[model samples]
Target: MNKFLLTFKDSKIEKDYQENKLNTLQKPIFYWLLVMSFTLNLLKVILDYTYYTVNNQSWMNVGFVILVILELFLACYKKQYIKYALIISNLSAGLLQINFDESNTFPQEYYSYGSYYAMLSVVVYFMTDFPYSVFQVFIHLSMKIFFTTIKSHRIDMLGIILGLITNVFLVLTLYICDWNSRRQFLLNLREVRWEESLPFIIKKPFYLFTYKDKNMSFQVNRAYNQDFFPYYNQEDCCGCNFRQFLRKCKVENNNLEIYLFDKRNEKLDFDLVYQNKTHKFDIRVCAIGLDQINYLIILEKLKLLTTSYIPKQTNLRQKIFQIKKTQIKYQHQKHFLLGVFSMFLYNNKEITSINLVDVLQKFSSRYFIISKSKIHIVYSDRSIYQLITYKHQLIIYLIQLFDCLINNQADPHSGIKLLLNQGLYAIRLKIYLTNRLKFQEQYKDNFFIQEIERNILSEEIDERLEISFLKKVRSAETSI
Candidate 1:
């Protein structure tokens, strides 16, 4: 019941119609209004010349002719404000012409009263806004009643009752029907817009988009916001629209809409000009979970990054990632052991995550890896260049710390010192031990000769692998 009484239940829908639909429908509605008013005036001219012309209303007929010509001129006018002013004036004049006449011609008879109904129907159709249309009608209806009482010097109850009933039925039916139709159209349009956007949103672009973080490195669309987009295409454009940002940054390589996706941990500069003002943004590509990544775009005004951020960002990134030293010491009375072994492997053999187990297999003894880092190495009292220590002895010492308390030693936490390094976890430690896999009896000259033989053998393997030009290129850079 409330929905019918009020054409639109939501104020947002009314706002949408005004903001979106009004400009689109403006010219067409104006043209239609012009045609209808022209036709009605033409019909009135024929009636006046053929039938009878009232002596008192002669000035009104001449005024109607001038107004019709003005309406025709307004139909060609481009400005909406001018066209609207003309429409309101014309409607007001038509209402006054009907009201200030003799009782038989306009107030009581079917012919003049029929024109009254025609005028109202045009008002309802032209001004589809329910509340405004009803407001206009209320003012007109009250004015007509006041005119009737003034002319007859009495209140005509029957006539007012008839006028009220006709108005209620006419305004409600036409306005509600029109609003409902437009409402459904808007709803269908919204659904279609979602369906169109689904393809781009399938990827992880929209969710993690933010601006102005130093750690932003997800993607760089070919040249983001290199072109100017027009402002008044109903576009309330903002940087928050991640999919639109991606689309705007798109370029066509060999196929359709290809975007540059950079997975490095870095910040990308994205510039956009909106509403005649330039905006500088910083975007960070960071991982949301293990599987998906988010791009953060921060506005420069909010975050306050200077112009020299680009050159200094490298040094800044290094500072962010610079490993801080962490020291941890544990002492146990239980006999703790430490050992270091100097192993000579083939020079060309590189230990990596993929071939770790495989390369360890190449060694003569079973060398279990505690851990290793590309930028970090271990140091011990005996030897380095593959140092073996209690660092790999996880299984033996796993439960010994807590179990020492159960054994009730005098000071289980005192003698044996456990070493720790924050840069390389549980790996780099200082300890005293005898070196294994090294013959102490052998002279230093003998150990040097063994290292030379391993180097020559590894070089021979490399020569065998690089047989052709294609093989050399492929081996030099696997990514190429």
Candidate 2:
């Protein structure tokens, strides 16, 4: 008998589905429901005082006050325990109301006045998983029916049927809604994961599309910013979309041959000044293709390219020599093309942004040079690259410390543009590490190498990777 019971319990459908459903529900949504339930119940009890006799008045008031206090405590101190706590408390209050209704000689409409809290409970817990919600409502209804029939020594078949119909209808409706919501949540989660992984595959924030015919439509249109170039005025552009703009441009520019046939197996860079009679803006277009149909499109604003900050040089020859000297001595950088990105194979290991204050604090305790050195890190999308050169004195030990702030690039120009707009002069370098496979494949079997990669690139940069990179520099200085 015990084995049969255990098997029955284990066979329950959608077990722990509430756990996933709760994860999708925002904390604000949880709090809003809690507040609404309490406020409505309090108002219901006060306004419908005729339902409660003088004998039961104190008990009902005391029970409600206690429930509210418990809810408030759960909201503040015991949030994790809310799912179980709330279900038990609500079920208890509902049973108490039914027990009181049994003593009355008059017709007891518990479903309308006393046990309507059960319906409210169902609505509140609907945000949880469906099965758990149905189970709670079933328990509440069963207790009400059992207690009422047992006390009165009679059963109302019509009343029982009505109660079942109302509560069961609510349960089924809520379950369907919850199921639909959970499905949509999962889809959105998958979409976000795809967006994050796309950059690792493409390297550049350029769009790729396939054209099977002279119509030249997109098979895959994934760009970092969907609004890279505006085709319509915000006020008058009610139905303007990227696809519509591309089709209109094909007709206006009459460049179907240039877009499809001429740019095959080659890269084409040109300036396109698009004018719609009312407005005009210059766009720099870069196109690269593998065959006639498949191609990559890179678009940038002409104003951005022309008005970009260019460092003033006293001597062009001397500056070039200095830059070369710095690159050979300090940079030793590896450039990765967006062309080589593969979802399974490619990984970027470059660290980009670092806090100036934190870097200074860590450096103060370290034993290293305070001499001026040129530190360059480049971050680019497709057309323009942001080059950040730090001329400040940097300690050697603090090299890998910046890895903690290195995030994979998503936007084409925002990070560098923000830095430029803010008038920041000393710090600028955007880097993407395109060789994470080195940490996985090259050193997968080597525990020592794996440790070195994790230490250098993880949340806190491992001191060992920084020391290893600078080992040659230290050795050369000692030899001299």
Candidate 3:
């Protein structure tokens, strides 16, 4: 036998050998079936009483009603004892209804009703997990069969066959369903255990602290990408315990940061800290510089490296970098911003390129006229350029450049326009610098520059850019 099977057997042995007796009440279904059985028995009692009343057996009618009232009281008050009460009530009522007198008896056909009652008892037994009630079902069935065979004088072959077949089928069906349910439950338990062990293998790098104003209606939201944080496989990850990993995370000022290393020699920094009265986390740094597509390629290569059957190689870094380059090239061709313009056209959608260009031109004209400075809008779909000039002499040529350059077909000048407009907006708004020439005299009387200075720092700019791209990707995925 397999070692795993031996472990399961050991567990079973421990469960069986243990003398501790915990409460084993029937589940909700058992209660429901019991109530239904009671209702059926009550109807049978009413029918029996009517028959006896018409035949002048008034004494039997009173006794039957008293027994039913007692059964109902026990069902309500002594709920745990209801199962035994039901069995006694059903058997007593069944016997009274038959009124089997040797001097005067009913037809053999009337006795077949006992088989239906027996089958119902079997159903209730199967629904319940209570060991005592389960044994009672077998005893009840045996008694019913004995009485039924004796009452009919000759054994009713049809009744005997039906009873045996139903018992076999009922038992088999219940056993299979129970076994399958157990197997699924065990599988789910294993999956949960694996999930709990994930954090150890991933070895998070940094914690991000966030806070939200209590007066504000909105709250801060943070998310992590699964591509960078790959699912941890149980076999390898199980060796690194989660509790130990958390201890080593080195918490400082109620903040914890951990560094994770992948098979490609790539490093990821994760930070965990309290924010908005709740724990917030962030991936502070990633050694893998590529975007989503490139990240996936590295992950695949790492899988091969980590697997036991694969031979380890010292040239892994070179192989990973090659894969990253291929992925970058593929993404540049497929998901480039310029490619979006073609996608819109191919889908028979109106291009927003012209609308964007018109908006920039109008903004530039208004700003130039108001300030008496030539605000040149030079932009492209990817880059934003602006020439901020006071009295024909260029003060500053703000170039809001894109990190990634791609070929765009629509409005061949879109990239140039994007760069120009972004620059114009930055300068007009005086986003970063406190003493920019355009905003120096006019904004000196205002507190906007002071506020902007506080808000638009270099770190804030990088965060905003990253957040903007993340939002765009998420929104695009939803639209698709």
Candidate 4:
């Protein structure tokens, strides 16, 4: 009981929990209370009418009947205005029963309408919060005292004592109900927060939940759960035991990378292997700081070298050709940028001996279509030109060759300009950049892609594309 009362001492937590409980239970409570109010008040009106008719009495019975009828209508018809309905129904019922009692008697409990106030007190406590229920109890108690004094033409000690006992019971019951509601709310708080934060939970594969402490070496008491690990309850620990790992690795911060060579049974003592012929992984660790000592660690496994599994039936030519075809096909499938560049001799009126197929095969190793104006290249998964040094240099050479054609009175339509225009180049760049940004953002979890992105790009391509595309357009316009 003392513990329960202590909960109310922290008014903020109590109020917060109370409001949460009310929000969760309000709809069901609303319906239940409405039904009870309608049934009870309807009975009250009927009883009052029958009594009045039998006795051939008037004022007090008529008033009680009218008030009960109002309560019934409020409960039935004015349901949407529930707060007002609850207040009016509870208040009106208690007041009418007290003021308009049939017996002109001291101590209203002995009268016909005595039990009505006590019943209404129960309803008030259940359907509303403590303060409001307490308010109603006080009002009912005060009215009972006032009425008893007036009826006896003196202060009735017995009636006052009974009212005080009833109010005490009501108050205690209200507190207990509220305390239970708060306890239930606290029990479901974690689940409620988790449900509300689905987006955060879905993205975070490994969640490190810990409690911060003042006495410990680390500010947090590390509570490890295996559920977040990829292979939960498996033989491979995957370095999940952070407490042990921290001691062995001599870690300063949350970021720690340790490579373990799994040799099926035996442990390697040297930790060094020649010619990259070992089962080794470059593990990258990135920690996201959540609190003082509580953090989320993202572990990435990268295989530097591995033995290739080859088919026994397939020869070297078949394997080489298959790999080449797969690379080209993948490039074609994920093509994000397409550029057209044509080549022609400086003094030639027309292409007499320039075989398009030969040029594409000899100069650019990538598959391309030879149009009348230029050789078209599609940058699918990446800039294939950037991968081959000669290919990049060859493109520059071809552009220069075409420029020489312009100087040598060659056809105006036979160059890079004929293949692509300024506006078209800008639009294509935008489309390419947008698609590439979207693609990178999609598969950024892959280790190889992250490595490539980190090494090859100065700034984030997506950021550059979005931020500097306009500047590129301006430069393109100026060049044009």
- lDDT score for candidate 4 against the true structure: 0.40
On residues 17-60, what C-alpha lDDT tens digit does candidate 3 reach at each position?
22111123333433565456456556656665665434434455
What is candidate 2's lDDT per residue for 1-480, written digit by digit as tens?
022111113322233334454455534555665676567557656745755554544456556656767777876785566666556655666655543434553555654665466555765556555566677778877886887688768997887898899887887686667656655555555555655675675443344555545654444445543333434222223223444445545523565334544455466566666543222334444554333334445443312121122223334335334434554322211111111111111122233434433444343223122222222222233223222211111222233222211222233132211111111112222223333333223233432222232212211212222111210111101110
Summarize candidate 4's per-residue lDDT along 285-347 as a digit string, tens digits.
322333222333322222322223211233534533444466442232222112111111111
lDDT of each: 0.38, 0.42, 0.35, 0.40
**Between the candidate structures 1 and 4, which one is better when assessed by lDDT?**
4
Total clashing pairs for each candidate? 16, 10, 30, 2
> Residue-wise lDDT of candidate 1 within 1-480, one digit each (tens)?
145444445687656665454556655665565566567666666666777655335456556656667765765564545435444653455454343346336435646665765665455445545555565566666866886687669999998998899878877776766667676667666655653563354322223332234644323322222111211111223332344445444333311012335332343334432211112323332333222323433222212112322224444335323312222233321221221011212122332222212222222022111111011122232211231121222212222211222122233223222232221111222211122112122212332222222211111112111100000101111110
Task: State the TM-score for model 1.
Answer: 0.34
Q: What ranges in model 2 sit over 4 Å off?
A: 1-53, 99-111, 114-118, 158-175, 206-480
For model 4, give the RMSD to the true fold: 17.2
- What's the C-alpha lDDT at position 148 in model 4? 66
Query: Looking at candidate 3, what is the lDDT of residue 256?
Result: 25
Model 3 accuracy (lDDT, Cα): 0.35
Better of 1 and 4 by TM-score: 4
User: lDDT order of candidates, best first?
Assistant: 2, 4, 1, 3
